[model samples]
Target: MNTKLLFSIAMILSISIITLMCFLSPAHAKSSTSPNIVLIISDDAGYADFGFQGSKIIETPNIDAIAKSGVTFTRGYVSAPVCAPSRAGLLTGRYQQRFSFERNLTTKEDLNRGIAQSEKTMGDHFKALGYRTAAIGKWHLGNKDVYHPNNRGFDHFYGLLDGSRDYFKQVIKKPADKYKVLQRNGELLTETTGYVTDLLTNETIDFIERNKTQPFFAYVSYTAVHTPMHAQAHRLTAVPESVVDPKRRKLIAMTASLDDNIGRIIAKLDQLGLSENTLVVFLNDNGGALTNASINAPLRGYKGSTFEGAIRVPMVVKWPGHIKENSHYDQTVISLDLLPTLLAAANAKPIENTPTIDGKNLLPYLSGANASSPHESIFFKYHSGRAHIKGDWKWMTTKLKQADGSKKLFKFLFNLKNDPAEQNNLLNSHPEKVTELRLEWQDWFFDMPGIWTQL
Candidate 1:
C-alpha cells in the first residue's frame, strides 16, 4: 500500500471517530456507559391476569420466565389508578397529586392527559446520558406535538398519540390516506393491517436491530387490554368461548396478543445477544377495572380506588448478571424508584440542583442492607378525603360508589398485614394509629397545589 493511501484511510477513520464521539460522549449527552434499558408497560393489566401472580385463568408463560430469571417484587406499586396520571408519576418519579394532575390524557374534552414540562422525567435524564431513546405504542401522556414523546427526550416516537385507536385499521397516523402513520423523528411506520400489539412488537424489534451496536432505551408501552376490545385473531386461538365470557372476550383477545408480543421481544433480546446486558422492567400502568371484567382477586376495590387493588401492581426486573434470579422481595417498592435505580445502574450521577426526590434506590433495599420501609408513611388523597399508611396500619375514607353514581366517603382504618383483604376495619380498635396517619396526610397535602378535580 502507498503511504498516501494509508494517510487517506487514517483521515477518514479519525473523522468518523469524531462524529461518533459527538453523539455518544458524556460531554455531549451527559450519560455513562451502561446496559440498554427496555421498559415494557402493560395497559390496564389485572393483578391476577398473569400466571406469576397466582392467576390460573390466563396463561402467561413468557412473563413468568422473567420472574424465574430475575427479581419480582411482591409489593410493587403504581402511583395512581389510571393510565395518564400513573405514567406521569412513573416517568417523573414524583407524586402526580403533587402537581394536581387528575384527568386523562385526552384534551379534546378539556382534559389534559400529559405532564407539565416543569417536571423532569426519566427519559430526560437518560437522554442527557447519551442514550438514543425511542417510545413505541401508547403515549397517552400527551396528544399535542409539544407534549409528544419526541419532544420529551425520546429521539424516536411511534404508535398513537391518543389513548386509544382502531387496531385493524391499516393506517393509524393517516387512516384515510392508507399507510401513512404518524412519524416523529423517523421511527414509527404506519401499520396497514396488523394488530396493534403485533405492530408495536414489530416496531420494537426493528429498533433493536437498528440500534444494537450502541446503547439505546426502548419504552414499549403496550396499549393492550384497554377499552376498544380489538386484538389480532392469530394470538387468540386457544380460548374456550364458554370460559372467555362475552363481555370480556375482546379484552382476553387483547391480553393474549400482548403476551405474544412480549414473548417476541424477550426472544429477540436473546437472539440479538442483548438479554444478559439489557435491563428489562415490566409493569402495569394501573389497576384493573370491573367494568372490563378484570377481577383483582385477593384485594379489595378496583381502579380509581384507594385500595391495594388500585396501587399495588406486578413489578418484575430482569437483568441476568445484575439482579438475582428467582428472588422475591417483600418490601414495598414504588414506581418512583425506577429513576434512581436506572441511573444508579448506569453509573449516572443525579443532577446537583434538582428538587427532592421521593424515591430511593432499590439496590440496597432489595439486597437487605436497608431495613426501614421505603417511606415511613405514604399519603393518599384522592378527593376531599385523605388517608395514610404507616407501618402495618392504614387509615382512609371509604368512598363508596352509590347507586346514583355519587361517592360517599366513609373514614376508617385497617391493619393491612393482619387483614390483607381489608375484611376487618380496625378504626375503632386502633384510634391512635388513625390519628397519627391523619396528621401525616394532612401535613403532606398542605403544601400541595390548589386541589380541584375531587368529586
Candidate 2:
C-alpha cells in the first residue's frame, strides 16, 4: 500500500477508538470535576404516596423518574419524626437531639428555638468550599435572626421561617402573618402571589441558572401536603374520583403539584447541561402527618410518634455518573447522612473544630466499595417516647395516658425485617434483645442535652 493510504487508515482507527472510549466512560468523565448538589425535600409526604414508592392514587412521575435513575433506600429514615428537628439533623448531619432540638416549636413565640448556632449546616459547609448555596421553601430551623438561613451560610434564602403556611395568597388574610407570609433573605413579601410550591420551584431554577458555571448546593424544601388541606381548585379537580374523602383528594392534588414542580427542577438541570454533574436528592423532611389525610400504610404510627411510619421516609438520590440507575439500598440509612454524602461528592471534608457528625458518608456503601450498612444503629428520642434500631430489631417505648388521667410507659420490640408494620411486639419474647437495646439507648441519651425548648 502507498504510505499516504496507510497514514489515513491509521488516523481513522485512532478516531474510532477515541469515540468508543467517550461513549463507554462513566458519566462523571464527561462532566465537570466538582458536582453540584440539589437537595429537594418534601414536607409531610407519605411513604406509599408517590409512584416511586408504589402509590396508585397519587401520581409522582417526575419524582419517580429520579428513583429510576438513582438509588432508592426502601428503609430510609429521618433523624427525627417531625419537621423542625428532622431538618436540623438533615442539614447538620447530626442527630438533632445532640443539640437539644428534640421537640417541634408549636407557636411563633418560640423564636429562641432553632438549630443550634454552633452546628454547621449543609449550606455552611458547601459555602466554605466556594460553592454558592441557596435555601428555598420552608425554613423551620429557626425564626430567630441568629438561626436564619442567611446566617447559617446560604447566599440566598426564599421561603417561610415558620413551620406551616397557607398555600395560596388569598388564604393568607393577615399581612403580618409571620408564619404564613413569604420572605426573601429576611425581607417579608406581603404582596407575593401564586402557589407557594411553584414560586419555590422558580427560585430554585433561577439559582441553578445563575450559578451554572460554579458548584452550588440548593436546598429546595417544599411544604406540600402538610396542613390546612389547601389545594388549588383546578388541581383538586384533577384528583381521581376513587379518592372519596375531600381532604384526601386535596392531599392528592397538592402532592401532584409537588411532583410537577420537581419535574420542572429536573428539567431545568437538563436544560442547563448540568444534569451530568448535579446530584439530586429527594426525601421527605419526616413522615406523613396525622392530618391532611396523608397515608403511611403498611407502616405503623404517624408523625410525632417513635414508629417506623413517622421516621422511615421515602428517600432517593440521583447522580448521573456516580450512582447506578434503578439501584436500591435496602439497609438502614437516615437523612443525617446527606451532609457527609454531599461533602464526599465535592471532594471536601468536614470543617475542623466542629463536633463529630452522626452521619456517615454513603458513597462507599452505595458504590459497592463497602458492603456493610452505613449505620450500625440508629436512635430516636422525643418527649416521653424513645426508640432504637439495631440490625433488624427495633425497640421502642411510648407513653400512654390511662382513664384515671395518669400516664404509663409501654415498651415494645419488633424485627423490622419481618414485621415492618410493628404489629407484632417481641418485647416479652426477647428480653435479652430489649435489654441490649435499652443499654445502648441509655448511652446515647446520656450524651444528649435535655430538650432546650418547651413544646
Candidate 3:
C-alpha cells in the first residue's frame, strides 16, 4: 500500500473513534438523557401558606428554596376542589370527572373504587420508561386489590391508604372507622413509631439511595397540615402561646415540620450528587380546610367550594439547569399538568391507548420558548356548583337552598385579573361574558359522562 493511502485510512479511523466517544460520553449521553423526578404533594394546604407564597408565620426554607431555584406558579390549581378527585386528576393527568371521580372518597365502598384500572398513571408511564417508581406517604387513591400502588405501577409503597391519620401514635378502629392507619404494600402496619412525615421522608431518602445510579420517580405525598392536627411538641416551640387557638398553633407547627422534611429530601438529593438532574415539584392536593384552621387569605371560599381559594394552590417546580431560577409563572397551571411535564423532562412517551391528557407540557412556557399561556381555559364542577375560567373572565354558579328546602342557583361573572377574590359580581354588567362561558362549560360538561349524581 502507498504511504499516503495508509495515512488517509488511519486518520479516518481516528475521526470515527472520536465521534463514537462523543455519542457515548455521560456528559452528552447515557445518564444525562433522562432526569430523575421527585413529585412532592401536600394535602389540604392553603394557597398562601408557605414562605414562598408570602406567608408571615410559616417558615418553609426548603420548600422556598425550590421556588428560588426554579419557577413558582402563582395561578396553579388542582382539577378538583377536594382531595380524591383532585388526586385522581393529578395521577392520571386528566379531569377526574371524565372518569366519574368527582368527590372525596368517603366510605369503604368508595375505597373499593379508585382511579380506573384502565387508566395509565404517571408511575406506570415512568416505570415503562425503565425507571424505578415508588409511592411514599399518602395514597388516597384506593385500597382495593386492583387500585393498590403495586398494581398502580409503583415498585414500593409505604404510607396510609385512607385520608387522615393521627399524627403521633394511638390507632382507633371501633366506632366510625374514619381514623387513618399505616399500610405497607397492602399489609397493615400495626404500629409505626416515628412521626409519619419524618418516616416518609426517610423512606424517600432510602429509595433515592437504592436507586441513585438510575433514574427514579418518587411521589412524596404528605398528609401533613391536614386533619388530626397533631404537631410534634418540639416543632411547636417557635410558635407562641399568645396565639390562643391551639389548633392554629398545632397547624403552624405541622407546617414548620413539613418544611423541615422538605429540606431533608433536598439535602439528600444534593448529598447523592443528584440535585442538578433531579426535577423537584412541590404542590398541594387542593385548597386548605377552614375547619383545620388553614389560612387561605386573599381568596374566597374553603376546601369543598369551586372558588379560587379552593382550587388554586401553591406550586413550585425546580429543574436545576433546565428551568430559569427564581421565576414566576402567573398564567393558569394545574396539578394535571405535572404528569405531562415530568414525562417530557424524563424523555418518556405516554402508553398506547392512554386517555386524552388534559395537561400541557409546561416546559416550553417555563423555558420561555412559548410566550403564550399553556392553557386557554379550565373548568371545575362539584355537586351542583360549577366554575369556568377563560382568559381573564370567570363564570360560576353557587347552589343555595331556600328556607323551605328547594335549591336556588346564584350565578356570578368576574374578571379574575381585576377581582381575584370575586368580591365584585359582574353578572349583571357583563351578560354576554356569562352566556359565553356558561355555554362553553355546558358543551364540556355534556362530554364528561356526567358524574355529580349524589348532589
Candidate 4:
C-alpha cells in the first residue's frame, strides 16, 4: 500500500473510535449520580381496576407498560385507608399517625391541619440533593400555606389545595371556594380549560422537558375516579360495553384518561433519553372509594376500612436499567418505602435530625440482592380500628356500632397466604396469634401520637 493511502485509513479509524467514545461518555448520557424521580399517584383507585392487576374490563395499557417495565408488588399497601394520611405516609416515609395526621380534613375549620411541618417529604429529600421539584394535580395534604407543596420541598405547585374538586370547572361560586381554584406556585388560577387529568399531564411533561438537563422530582398526583363521577364526555364511549351502570362507566372513562396521561409521562421520559435514569413510581393514594363506583373486587371492604381492599393498592416501580422488566415481588411493600427507596437510588443520605424512617429501602430487595421481605411486619391504625401483619398472618381489630348507639370492638385473625379475602375470621381459633399481634400493635400505637394529637 502507498504511504498516503495508509495514513488516510489510520486517521479515519482514529476518528471513528473517538466518536464512539464520545457517544458513550458521561457527557453524552444521563448522569447516574442524580436520577430523576416521577411519582404518579391516583386517587381512590381500585386494586382490580387496571390491566396490570388482571383487570379484563378497564384497560390501562400505559400503567400496564410500567408494570411490564419494572416490578409490581402484589402485596402493596399504604399507611392509611384514606386520602390525606395515606399521602402523608407516602411523602414522609413514616406512618402519618407518627406525626398526628390521622384523619381527612373535612370542614373549613380544619384548613390548618396537615402533615407536620417538621417532617421531611420525598420532594424535600430530592430537592436537598439539588433536584428541581414540581407537584402537579391534587394537594390534599393541607389548605394552609404552611403545608403547601412549595413549603413542603416542591419548587413549583399547580393543583387543588382541597381533597376533591370539580374536574372540568374551577370557577369560585362562593367566597368559601378557595379549594375550587387551581394554584400555580403561589398564584391561584382563576380559570383553567380542558380536563384536569390532561392538564396535570401537560404540566408534568413541561416540567420534564424544561428540566431535562437537571434532576427533577415531579409528583403527578391525579384525582381521577375519585368523586362526582366527572369524566370527559367522549371518554365515556371508550368504556367497555359490558359496564352498564352510568356511574361505573364514568369511573372507567376517568381511569382510561389517567392511564393515557401516564403513557404520555413515560413517553416524555423516553423522548428525553431519561427513561433509564428516571425512577417512575405509580400507585393509588389509597384503595377504591365507595362513592366513586370503584371496584376493589376479591378484596374485602372499600376505602376507609382496614381491609385489604382499602389499604392494598396496585403499585408499580420502573427504573429501566435498575429494576428488572416484567418482574414481580409478592412480598409486602408500602407507600412509605418510596422516600427511602428514592434516596437510596440517588445515593442521598437522610436529612439530618429527622425522625427515624419507618420504611425500609427496597432497592436491595427489589434487585434480588436480598431475598428476605423489606419488612418483618406492617401496622395500620385508623380511628378505633387497627391491624398488624407479620409474615402471612394478619390480626385486626374493628369497631362496630351496636343497636343502641354503642360501639363494640371486635378482633379477627387470618392467614393471608391461604385466605386473602379475609372471609374466615380465625380470632377464636388462634387466640395466641391474636395476643402476639395485639401486643405488637400496642407497642406501635403507643410510640405514635394519638389521633388528632397535634391539633
* C-alpha lDDT values of all predictions: 0.76, 0.88, 0.86, 0.88
As a TM-score, model 1 comes out at 0.87
lDDT of 3 by residue, 266-339 (tens): 99999999999899999998889987888888998888888888999999999988999999999999888999
Candidate 4 structure quality by residue, lDDT tens digits, 326-369: 99999999998989998888877788867889999999998889
Residue 255 alpha-carbon offset, candidate 4, angstroms: 0.6
Q: After superposition, how far is residue 424 of candidate 2 from its true place, in Å?
A: 0.8
Where model 4 places Cα greater than 4 Å from the true spot, the runs are 1-32, 400-408
Clashing pairs for model 4 are none
Model 3 RMSD, rounded to 1 decimal: 4.4
| Candidate 2 vs 4: which has more TM-score | 4
Q: After superposition, which runs of candidate 3 have C-alpha atoms over 4 Å from their true positions? A: 1-30, 170-172, 175-179, 400-408, 452-455
Question: What is candidate 2's TM-score against the reference?
Answer: 0.90
Q: Write one digit per residue (lDDT tens) for candidate 2, span 306-364.
A: 88989999999999979999999998999989998998998779987567999999999
Q: What TM-scores do the predictions have?
A: 0.87, 0.90, 0.90, 0.91
TM-score of 4: 0.91
RMSD of each: 5.1, 7.4, 4.4, 6.3
Measured by TM-score, the strongest candidate is: 4
